[model samples]
Target: MKGGATVPIGLTPEQGQLQEAVGRFAARHAAVDQTRDSFEALAEGALPKWWNDLVSHGFHAVHLPDGVGGQGGSLLDAACVIESASAALLPGPLLPTVIAGAIVLSVDDMAAAKLLSELAAGATATVVLPESGDLSATATDGGWRVTGASGDVLGVRSAAVILAAARRDDGETLWFVLDPEVASASVEQRDGTDLTIDVGMLRLADHVVPEALVLNGIDDDAAWDITVALSACASAGTLQWAVDAVTEHLRTREQFGKPIGTFQALQHEAAMLLVNSELAAAAAWDAVRAVAEAPEQRQLAAAGAAIMAVAPAPELLLDALTMFGAIGFTWEHDVHLYWRRATSLAASMGPITGWSRRLGELSKTHVRDMTVKIGEAEADFRAGIAAVLDEALGLVNDKPSPLGDYDHLASGPQRTLIADAGLMAPHWPPPWGLGATPLQQLIIDDEFAKRPELVRPSLNIAEWVLPSIISSGSEVVQQQLIPPTQRGELLWCQLFSEPGAGSDLAALSTRAVKVDGGWRINGHKIWTSSAQYADYGALLARTDPDAPKHKGIGYFIIDMRADGVEIQPIKTADRDPHFNEVFLADVFVPDEMLLGGPTDGWSLAIATMAQERVAIGAYVNIDRAIALRRLAAQRGPDQDAVVRALGELDAYTNAIKALGVRETIRLLDGQSAGPASSIAKVATSIMLRRTFKATLELAGPLAMVERSEPAIVAPYLRLPAELIGGGTRQIQLNIIAQMIMGLPRK
Candidate 1:
């Protein structure tokens, strides 16, 4: 993927232009050789000329208030600038200086205000985070005495002032802006993994600091949040570069007479790296927005960024290293350079355990009722839709139940009411649907969400099957069934896989014979969900036995109640009979029931499967994610192990949600689903397994005794089905390799 290949995660057009400009500057000034030279220069207490250029550009003042003599931009702007710099491997004091400026500008005191101006004017700054060992400050006659030591302080060598947190005698943490040149300190340069940046140890003796240098009311938590958010942004940019670099390698590098990217294994690895990169991007972007727009949720967002990006950055980079093969091991390749920076950034944020525990504690209480702003036009559209839905709900309630006490939503006046209001399938075209755009579709869901009591009718199989039918099914079939299906007048099932065919659907042995007025079908379909209750099925059978396997297949709409159709319930691990085996013995189907043509079933199946992937992959199971958090909160205090797992589950769940949001945006932009779409099912499968395992672990002895939480334990028994259903994880990977990555088929 290129720079603009996918939309820059959370940037506006203006910010994107800024990013491009910074990128061009970095390209000219921060080449690999230049980075090495700057590192050496910083070690000798000399500033590189490019550092002044950056300051002149106002990159260091992006997060500061204009009233304090700095640019009045949001934290998001600072994030973008640092991200661009990090991507080019620019060695600088930008991150720390920007963070320090934020703190100084936050206070209204004259001294703090004056410091903010100096910072914005390009005075270099370094930070010693709260996670560093206790640095104490005690009040003296007219000043304060500070004493402590911090290791691995980035930009310390070139920093004019150091921003640090120290505990006072009253047990309150105070933010102090100390001039390294003014204090008695020893700054020794140290060698580290990332060679492009300057880092060193700072030893501060018991020295007196003037009262003007100390800023009151700066909470330790607030400072930590700022540092984590900024570091995450920088790390995210580096990881993205790794992703693109590795991708470029796979595209051009060849092995054994073909491009190595043609291999399925490599494609799957690249796909996962892409997933991690997106997750990091979303996390960093969301964190900065939280700090700027929703201060109340800032802690939660910062912790989420750590859990999602900071902790995983190093590992993702290592994976990228693996993709680069032996050549990446050498220093010349720049892979090791990124790996070092990733690890260094992770270390700077402190231990992952502490972050996870904080995240767990926060997740236990946070409701996560997040809503992204989609502009005033979208807002008005949502309001109108909400009013319409409110009226529809009142009308439905006034009428008697057309379900006739059946208590099911598959059919009845309730379904009819929703269908009449064009709410049944808003994504579909008019009459049957409202032809809603992606954003409009979201707005519709938002309205429906407000009415939790009103059940949205669904035809489980028709969710994707009906869409496929409308796209390729004959006009008669669409006209006859689509409206009824939308109205909840008919239920549908799918019969595309046989026991012997499973992932290899084209090898199905089911046979369809053409007759004078219809086709005679004889086939056996297994693992069909809701088959016994289905009124119809989107069936796939062989029409031309002599042709190739895929070319001979045809798709049709078969009446489940037709003569010679046998449906036998198959008990699953949970002992529920939702799945069934259908055996068709010369089942007769009218020619009108055929979808597309006799030789188009394979293509139709592909389209339907893609839709299925999108539907399943984009569905965020917020309830499940929240339930785990609740369990962690309710568990015994001694259950630290389970709490850690709970935190991990929370992070993974949020990651899935973030990935879904990206996919939705991609679709809204009219970009077709790519490799990310293919791997979503795979990623979700892994997430489910981890979630269930954590739930069971949290349950402990309770799971072994009698019946446990049905929602938690039962899913374990059905986990294998999820991995195998829709398509096996391996099959999905193969699709990603061949279709999305352009790999040659085996």
Candidate 2:
């Protein structure tokens, strides 16, 4: 969590320091044994000394203001501490205490303030709402009589002070504080799955005669927001522990004389668990930060937290246990303990169905706001671009719409007008681009997004290839290629993948012999998308057979019209001829066409591949998730199997969308996409496969016959291409593990 020049998404440097500090504290005082001992002590009507130690050490009051006998820090700081403590299996009273402290601090009750100061120093508190109890209170002369029962309240018996919400005769909910020690309250301990915290039922019979103890004003929204945020942090922390534990078990547990982790199935499963943990972490941090910085965004953030934390934590823990084999099932192992804790927390979170629906409802409006952060100038830029687009829309209004399958406008007056204005390639350098800053680029995106019908010409690889070429290609190559590519006058396809070398492109046998002021290329490329329609291709060939696989390569721009260059369509499973195989028998490339150094194709290819992955990862289609959800809603969730499948698809699809937002935010911040893009690419592919499969399943008999819903059946058939294209899912996982996770290669 420690930040450098570039911090991870949703976290700042100070938050990182807080996370590190809490991690160290957890390592020392909140391990598995400590958690077990805390449970044992609770059974004996004793509280763990660690709670007081935390208060004494100032960790308890980190989120409170200095005037309240605490350190003034953001809620994000509090969430970090909670996350780290949860990772160590720390008990739950601290979580409830921190949340209650925040709520009490927001009101103007002197009695509550005194109790909060005590909580900041060492005391623990619990808040029980209507969801947790049947509690009710009535106002009397100078005091209130409270009588109700609260069930499934964690740490209720252990907390010295309790905050309970009850409805009056007027149907209004009021918040009151109860001093359990002084009040006539009885606590009955209940057998629960989570051994780390004492869950019990609390009954108050005509107790709490004190108007002074009632908070002046109660904001249930603020209370729930704080609780949800802290609970999400705990879930994130525990999920991380489970993921790490399972990962370590996989690395060490061997089967058939080899480590189980070597198996691709286990690798993918572990990688998925890691992905879930990441989503939880990102969501939790976002929620906490929203609480600290933007109160308006709190509901959206809490919804994200509710969906991510409650839905995934238990499942991830169960996955970890499954990965651990029979040992994980045994009582002696700690995996089951984590599973029990997760299940208990999930139950307390109520129905996943409601939270999932809430998330879906919030996504439409909230996600757009979270995608980018723009300043005043960028806002002005957007307005200016909007005016220009309005004018451009006028130009296309009366003209015959030539946007048919065979007659789409690629290069016409409409495209030419926009391209000339530098809107086509805003990120590219001047003459061909505006060299717009990240904010300006986002502004361009905002403007172009308004006109969905005005399609930008698919320059294919030229979008990425042209930029790489501009950076490294000779002046002649840049001047001749950049302008035309920008103007949509040129169409290009990449010719890097060969039949013998798809993922292993460096091992390609494509030979390029140096000739008189040119090179004779003799090679074959396969699975080239749109190769049949390309005017030219960005090609890779071996110039030195003696050099190593990655070192002996050269890149060139080969004209598709050259002699001996034959293109044959490769029919896919969908019966589409969009992909083609090209045989370069003896194609000649002039010396000026060579890109970068002779032996530098590998480096350039890596650069290009990186950009490709980013592009693929950033391809967020909002309609895709919505369509699947609509399909599920039509099918209904009456059957458990269908409901399970639909829920899984929805969760994964939403996660992909979240990952896209993170990636876009990173781009807008001018940060490197790095290996994380592979993570997103892999997640997207998996989500797509599952989503389409679930769609078909939901359709039942209707799926057998092709319908006009080309969006559904067409994508299902073409999904294999996506899984194989832009690196296979397995290859992406390898990159994620090796490059991002730093796991040793096979």
Candidate 3:
């Protein structure tokens, strides 16, 4: 397009073309719904014959270098082709074949070329061992014998050859190639939830390989990389399939005469899925590319993926299935195929949760590794913030304004300043903070809000538009848009949440059609905050109503100054004109203004919203709780009921807080949120309600004491407002009970 200097991640043109060709070839022979069914029916150890076509498709050798008789494709090619294969739920020996081939190449084994060539030519192969449960190869003799068996070998039943890792007498583990035709081999059958891998035990005895065949010893980094890479790709593939399927269903399927996806409960679910999807993708890429990154970074990335996969991905899929109702359970439905494969892959690699524990183990190694490197940006920032926070905190007695008591708004400006100082930039990319030390991110985050005059991020303009643009918009768009917006420069508004579909966003009927060189957007967006003062608006409009629900949506950055736009400010419970009723009679947005592609808007919106709701759950409720606690302290010793209530409140709050932390850790560890956050959000709201009730009772009839200044009552009045702000309390419970607990819906 213009001056072509852009670096496209790890993808090369030759690799791209080769991947496309391979995809076409594989698709021709790929397992269809019927083929998968047939494969499932075949008992014993037999794999479907179509698997041979995958070998012929050059899939197994896709990641191998040219010297190994491979197309010498790039890793991106491997990911792309494998993801496509996974989406179709293609069944065969590809995972094991490729993984084994990579293992062989990893150890610098020359025998890999011949075996990989055979695999590329259609002979399925499997990697039998990687030093046991910890994946560190162990003990040997007569060269290296395939002794202690590997239980997770997916293609063991079909492989004519297997590569097993065993340790030499020197206590070094090495890869040993086993020609099944030569060795005594047997595959143990096991049934598991995730059906993607037909897992079996590869039993081998007396199979021997000399020094030439013993790739690299146990300490070889390449062998571990290859194994981790394969497992990661499969996991990533499973996550993608689950997310895509759920998105499709939630968008099209109907409930209460509207698209079910428009529901807050569903959108939040989808948001969680999107976060897991992105983080998981990042982790997989991180692991695949870790061979090139610094040691600790690689380990950290893998840890991230394992954390996400264990909890959110599985929970999301199961939630999606339950959302789909009865049809999802049937064998004929393709949905179960993804569920089966996702869980199976997890079990195969000891699941994402186990990887996290592995990550925890790996974490120990990284502490020392960090000592070997220099990290100035992260170091300076942490030092700078901590020193400033501790020193300045003593001076922040209280605000002169009434906000000192009603901290919800009082905290907003300080939060904005902290963000301006780049503390909020931790989760953001390098342009923002220390791209390293994600662990320290949490610590600094608490510091940002807890510092005296405890301010939090502003609600309007900056929060809504800047992040949304950076994530999905082009470099050109971000350059023109983000800097100014981020500097508190340009004010923006969100034109979503119509009266017709407050929670059911995808059900919106606003239309945006391509016109001239750009788009003519004509839509009515209700419940829009800051729309009246907006310089720009983040608009979600229906691009193709004819297309499926989610498929038709488009995300656009619209100029609020455009002639046709009209905004009507709406007053809320606070008796202030905050949210706007925006009418886009006919607004135009060019190609440059669109975020990502047309359809990806749904995905972006979901991502943006998820971070938002979670942040609100984390940040917003704190002040309200603290205000209640402080007010309770001010009310002397006479209120027994309030005291007893506060006691139970402390106990419940502690339990809920602990649950929140663990659930967060689980999601972080690649496990599911499993209704934990949903429960937290609802409980927070409920507790706040209880706390407010106690405050009113303890006001000892002065609870009705009205002050001239309305701000005086804000501390007490704000709880009800927050309960309704992000998403309703009722929806959160429905999600917790239905998705997390597997309870029947009301």
Local distance difference test, each candidate = 0.75, 0.72, 0.58
* Tens-digit per-residue lDDT, 225-276, candidate 2: 6777778888887787876777667667778988787787777777777767
lDDT of 1 at 734: 70
Which model, 2 or 3, shows the larger lDDT?
2
Count of backbone collisions within predicted model 1? 0
Worst 10 residues of 2 by lDDT: 1-10
RMSD of each: 3.4, 4.2, 14.5
Q: Which sequence of candidate numbers ranks them by TM-score, best first?
A: 1, 2, 3
Name the candidate that leads on lDDT. 1
Question: Model 1 residue 321 lDDT?
Answer: 90
Error of 1 at 173 (Å): 1.5
RMSD of 3: 14.5
Question: lDDT tens digits, residues 551-651, model 3?
Answer: 88888899889978988877775566656788878787888887878777787677666555565565323533343344444546753344344443442
Question: Candidates' TM-scores?
Answer: 0.90, 0.86, 0.52
Ten contiguous residues minimizing lDDT sum, candidate 1: 399-408
Where model 1 places Cα greater than 4 Å from the true spot, the runs are 1-7, 37-39, 42-46, 65-72, 102-105, 141-143, 293-296, 375-380, 392-411, 474-476, 545-552, 625-631, 634-637, 663-676, 709-711, 741-746
- Model 1: colliding residue pairs: none
- Model 2, residue pairs in steric clash: none
Q: Please write out the lDDT profile of model 1 over residues 367-435, one tens digit for every residue.
A: 343564455557777877787777666644332223233322445566676777777788888767889
Model 2 residue 459 lDDT score: 47
